[model samples]
Target: MLGRLAVDVAIYRDRVQVTERKSGIFIDQRADHPFSSDTQLVADATRFEHALSHALRQILKTGAYMLYEPRAVVGPTDPALTPPERALVRRVLQDTGFRRIEFEDE
Candidate 1:
């Protein structure tokens, strides 16, 4: 079976926005603990990448055996992503043969 999976991700200074297409579910996740005072950019980027990966994995688990046409939605003014973070996202999309990323206004 073939399925369509669309993920909308928006990165913000304090949080990450994720939307699952099939279920129309929206999740706003903090990149780090609210009380943490860490200022390391790398840490922040890692957290974002981990959060994003986890969300994507959860969604993919739903249709493990099906072929998926993945799509990503992001905003141009989205939060600053480190090189590794950007590469990770691109790699994930490429691994899934994702279609063109859709840009949207915040």
Candidate 2:
């Protein structure tokens, strides 16, 4: 349906970012590679690839590059998340294209 097709996509050199703004923050996620014509349901297709790639690698080991559910950029990480647990956050955010948010360890 047209409503389901209204998602946005951002292509990076090494990955594609999909975002949906909620509240005031942007829920940004990366797709591990550049996007092509065959990709579906993209809005605001722009040259933000570098911005994403850089944020993924240069910012904190856990950066805003991976937020599956875009809520207001609130306080720190949940007290229950560990180091590897934190990485799981990264993976889930990356896998948003498939509507997934669970880690193998979970």
Candidate 3:
């Protein structure tokens, strides 16, 4: 892929999975623990974001700073996600600095 194509983010209620599409560097992490939280996802948006950002940084070869310019495919596939929940997902991805975002279900 040309300079790292993109990353795939799949967020579950209690877990988040990220894959760097080019290198296939993937991370499947619980939403709690190091970030500190209950098992429920989105319960604390900051914590969820922290955990996600952490996962992304771990997979991105360059670093989390590289997040801003990259295209990201975010698919939150639990029960198809409600509109507000989808909006939350988008907002979080945007907050993570992804310049381009696509939803797998949309």
Candidate 4:
């Protein structure tokens, strides 16, 4: 792969035992610890290359917290996503049926 892809996700078993596309990476530091998702790059792999450096930075910065926080809620306090990153996020969330909740910076 020419680019780097990362995600932060939660893992859940289904009724049917099937291999699924893993959207996250896991760090098994302890038995109590659970597998975590890679939430850094929520975009498709092809596009992830565009933000590889940023995504890697995010992963390195937040890797330790992945198990505790699998999902990220982007608030105004959250640094704004770059134009391309925002577009990618919007596209992915829309595809997954997540309502785009845009809020103005108060």
Which model scores highest in TM-score? 3
Tens digits of per-residue lDDT for model 3 on 1-106? Answer: 3363488988776678898887778899776644322443455567778878878767755543343378889775755666766677778878877778899877
lDDT of 1 by residue, 1-106 (tens): 5457777877655465677767776776665443112442234434556666666666666664333556888755334545565565566556545665655642
- Model 4, 1-106: lDDT tens digits are 1112223322121100111114344332221222212433232433332233233344445434333212222333233344654566445434433343242342
TM-score of 2: 0.23
Q: For model 2, name the residue pairs that clash.
A: 15-33
| Angstrom error at residue 94, model 1 | 4.6
TM-score of every model versus the real structure: 0.54, 0.23, 0.76, 0.28
Candidate 2 residue-wise lDDT at 48: 33
lDDT of 2 by residue, 1-106 (tens): 1112112333333343333332122335543343322323221233233334443333223233343442211123223345553453344334323243333234
- Total backbone clashes of candidate 4, pairs 3 or more residues apart or in separate chains: 10
Q: After superposition, how far is residue 80 of candidate 3 from its true place, in Å?
A: 1.4
* Residue 39 displacement in candidate 3 (angstroms): 13
What candidate 4 gets wrong by more than 4 Å, as runs, is 1-73, 77-79, 103-106
The collision pairs in model 1 are none
Instruction: Please say which candidate is ahead in lDDT: 1 or 4.
Output: 1
Give the better candidate number (2 or 3) by TM-score: 3
Q: lDDT rank, highest first?
A: 3, 1, 2, 4
